[model samples]
Target: MPLSDDALDQLFREARTHSAWLPKPVDDALLRQLFSLAAMGPTSANSSPGRFVFVKSAEAKAQLKPALSPGNVEKTMAAPVTVIVGMDMAFYDYLPKLFPHTDARSWFVGNDDLIRATAQRNSSLQGAYLIMAARSLGLDAGPMSGFDAAKVDETFFAGTTIKSNFLINLGYGDHAKLHARNPRLSFDEAARIA
Candidate 1:
């Protein structure tokens, strides 16, 4: 059966990108649950390249501060948890476990162009899944790509194959601080039947 309208509202229709948060902290268990839900989403060759870094500690948040753009600094720093959605470039190494039925790893090994494109694209899909998972779990998300990615990488993923894709601030949002909803493109303007 399809999900109810209330579920649709919770996941999409009524969800908003939150910039202001309540004073409560998000539990680590909830973060783990969110990732578990997001990981179930489909990826090419089942190569789930998404790697996440939950910057929840004061020290981690401080480390992330310099990388954020001026406009993002205040809201991000104030957030309970800021997730660094990342792509693991060496993700094909896990194809044996993720796609055991076929030799999928061979498809990407030594293919730099394919690796970069696939990793970036699939990780972005995983990140969107994460946002939806957060909303489903009664949390708010503010996903952004406005930060200095290189700095975030150097600070958080040095000597690792994982590269930051985007940031998502997660928490209970203060709806009173939100602005009016903006417009979106209509189906006619964005879609076509082939």
Candidate 2:
């Protein structure tokens, strides 16, 4: 559906991170469309570092079970899908074309520190893009930081440079279960002009 101004406001302005979900499944085609939109969002050096692992099956969610905090386990497992947002530490390897006219790829290859930093920064940006993308596609999101990073790495990223950034549960949410919208800081409270 085309997003009207009111629709855009409804998607972001009033959106909540839903902890409870309806049983409706997010179809594969819609998931693909969501990603197709999200991947086009910008990243530094065009180093698209984000790699998503969509955990939909019972078997996959089982693998993710040990990584969750006790409080997060049931809600996450009950969702239709839990996305594993990851960052490729070697994301800059493709920067020859991604950020051409400079040796940006060389900038990260030698410095483990720089590579890690850029991967994390860019991947986090991608995760935000994922949230907006999901909202635009009419899916409710529950992004969570309550998980064991080490266990997630062991279960999902073993033998790879990809590291888990966070997890986001995706599905049709039950509006009846939503909490009242929480307060947000105003611009004066959050930002300052130098």
Candidate 3:
């Protein structure tokens, strides 16, 4: 069954990109649940490539600070958690386990361009799923791409094949601090049904 209008609004129309967060912390269990829900989202060839690092500790936040742009530093530090959404270049290695019914790994094993494109595209889709899942579970998300990807990868994903794609600050948002909602482009201006 389709969700009700209120449910749809809560997940989309009323969902704002939060900048300021409440003082409350997001629990580990909620983070786990968030990932569990996000993982169910579909990916091409079932080549699930998204990897996440939830930065919550003060030390970890300090490590990530150097990579953040000035405007993003304060809000990110204040956030209860900052999720590093990444793409694993070696994602196809697990295709045997994730897409076990077919010889899917062979399709990407020797193709760098295909591997890169698939990882980036699917991981991006997974990140969006993460945002929606968080919202559905009563949390706010602020997805940002304003960091130094190289520094983030070095600091968070060293000795690994994962590359940072973006960052998302997660927590209970302080709605009082929100700016007025901006106008969005209508379907006529932004899309078409060819």
Clashes of each: 0, 0, 0
12: Cα error in model 3, Å: 0.4
> Arrange candidates by TM-score, highest first: which order?
1, 3, 2
Q: For residues 26-46, write the lDDT of model 1, one tens digit per residue.
A: 999999999999999999889
* Model 3 residue 78 CA deviation in Å: 0.4
User: For residues 74-177, could you state the per-residue lDDT of candidate 2 as single tens digits?
Assistant: 99998999999999988887788788889988778789898888889989989889888998889999999999988998998999989999999999898999
TM-score of each: 0.99, 0.94, 0.98
Q: What is the lDDT of residue 166 in candidate 1?
A: 98
Summing lDDT over every window of 10 consecutive residues in candidate 1, give the lowest-scoring window: 185-194
Residue-level lDDT of model 3, residues 26-95, one tens digit each, is: 9999999999999999999889999999999999999999999999999999999999999999999999
| Residue 100 shift from truth in candidate 2, angstroms | 3.3
TM-score, cand. 3 vs. native: 0.98
Ranking by lDDT: 3, 1, 2
- For each candidate, C-alpha RMSD in Å? 0.6, 2.0, 0.7
Local accuracy by lDDT, each model: 0.97, 0.90, 0.97
**Candidate 1: clashing pairs of residues:** none
Question: What's the CA error at residue 133 for candidate 3, in Å?
Answer: 0.5
